[model samples]
Target: MIEFWLCAGLLLLTALAFVLIPVLRGRKLQAEEDRTALNVTLYQERLQDLQAQNAAGALNAEQLAAGRDEAARELLADTEGAQALPPQRTLGIKVPLVFALLMPLLGYGLYQHWGAIDDVERARTFADQPKTIEEMTARLEAAVKSDPKSAESWYFLGRTYMAQERAADAAQAFERAIEVAGRAPELLGQWAQALYFAGGKQWTPQLQALTDEALKADPAEVTSLGLLGIAAYESGQFKQAIGHWQQLVAVLPAEDPSRQAIQGGIDRAREQLGEPVEEAAVSAGPGLTVQVALADDLQAKVQPGDAVFIFARAVSGPPMPLAVKRLTVADLPAEVRLSDSDAMMPQLKISGFEQVQLVARISRSGNATAGEWVGSSLPLASKTTEPQQLLIDSADSKAP
Candidate 1:
């Protein structure tokens, strides 16, 4: 706020100076006009004197002609000089006063309304925050509107929405970006990620096509390889999955969290295929349940393809958010119950909190459409109760 005031004050003062400078150095119109008139009168008087001498027969014809020519020349020179000076404008006090007042106001108004300064500041702040998948989607929408041509913004939007489990929106956004960007590697990777996640239980040849295209462009892209490995792993293509994972491991840092995650996944794939498990010191936590309930039925207004954000926070800690989950409407249950047994639940540590705050939200377009949050007193060590269920039907006294 202080910074805002300082900037505004500086602008106002600058405008004030602009107005005062012109007023202070203003030309003296009255004095210049008087001087011009006096010169013209003096030249006319000299010409009259010459004419009188000629009329009195005290001057020859040549002398009279020369005197007349000289007088004419002097008169012409004075006229031209007067014309060379700019004419002065006599403004009422209101003109400068209005200008002085309006200049800063107009400038500040424009700056506040359409300037990039504030948007950039907002963007920086948003980036600094721990963005939930839903929040990232909204921010991506804002960023795209603010700068439509930014490829990075568009790509990030597609990726983020995909992460939030909004496949259709992700596909559409990716398609739009692809129209503008053509076949860039990063864009292909983003699009492939969306497709891979969206296909879910029915991932098939279509998923492979996007993955192939993405890998063709950038063979070493860790995300592309990771998705390919997962897809192959899911389809019981153990060799193929191992091949992809091994490539990813080679390219990724050994200490990368993602590497550890992929390794764990690869280990599972190997075990499923009757291969030996690689024993890595992974901190495995106890499993728990995550229940998403709506206060009322939201299916009529929300689609299965829409994005839903799920988050859990510990009851007794800094709001440093414990776990976040995102899924498409398709992944959501009418009142979904997630147990620790689910593989994707690994990314979210449900066992970490004894008492936690759980929130479920769905965004229509880019705004929140349906949401329910529960502050549960249940401990992780305690037996999971009828997994916290959220009913979608609203219990409002008035119609929505």
Candidate 2:
């Protein structure tokens, strides 16, 4: 701002020079005009003296004629090199001074009302690279506030919010971006991710709709596919997770930094389901029923779409599940049966375990192997006819 004012003041002075130059020259011309008039007055007075001398009879005719000729010569000499001056204008220094003051004031006033000073400052601020994410985000927030309809500003703000883990705010910023910039598929995917995380990693119909819409618009939309994979994996739908992740991987360039992580996730998912990477998965099982219900104390804190993993494992054996079934909080207090079809491997079966432990876990991050809540039943014989009751009333013994 100081720099701007300095430059503006210099410009105002430059303009004042134009007006001041002519006023100064007019004063110089006036001085010349006054001297010319005084010379003419003195010439007339000399002629008057000669006439008085003639009237007093102090000179002869020849002498008077000689004197008149000499007087004419003197007049010519006095007036030599004089030219007629043009009529002076009534222009005054006061008018120029008033103009000088008004020119700067009016110009400065108009500029303040509609100038790029803010933009200039913004540019300068950015040039001095911000040292932190918080600083950069602060600048973006101010930019959007000043330009509410700038789609680019909103987009970057959303990304920054996402990086800062303010998913809800990120979601709002992406929505504003789409409203201002149009429904680009990438924007939709980002918006969906923020919405998904903002809802505590629960996959709702709204989130599903957003990802579905994004993929429909651009089949290879990476964020949408990655989100779907996350949702599927957390819900213990390993095959579906593999499919989404594989698709995402295929679309990504080989040099992409995310490809390795995503591929690792796919491999982990396939391994969890005991499916060979080279072959498609097939289901088999020794089926059994378990009824799952959340303890009343925990019902208020969980999402309906949160992943629920139910499985039966040998009481004291390999520690691996013989059979597993996936559901969600929405299916609570309901009986879900796992069979040989739910076996982690082609050979593993619930029928192999004479005594098994039935377990249910609710994972917020979509990882069936780990979660925030868990419930299990005491050892029961495979021949046991009663329905096993599982209560997800306690915190999980593991972390995601």
Q: Highest TM-score, which number?
A: 2
Best by lDDT: 2
Which lDDT value does model 1 have at 399?
Answer: 19
- What is the C-alpha lDDT profile of model 2 across 277-349, one tens digit per residue? 5432222123566888999999898999998889888786656566677788998888877655456544456
lDDT of 1 by residue, 303-327 (tens): 7776665555556543433455566
What stretches of model 1 exceed 4 Å from their correct place?
1-27, 30-36, 39-135, 176-182, 199-209, 281-322, 326-400
The TM-scores of all predictions, comma-separated, are: 0.51, 0.55
The window of 10 residues in a row where model 2 has the poorest summed lDDT is: 278-287
Off by over 4 Å in 2: 34-102, 105-115, 147-149, 277-400
TM-score of 1: 0.51
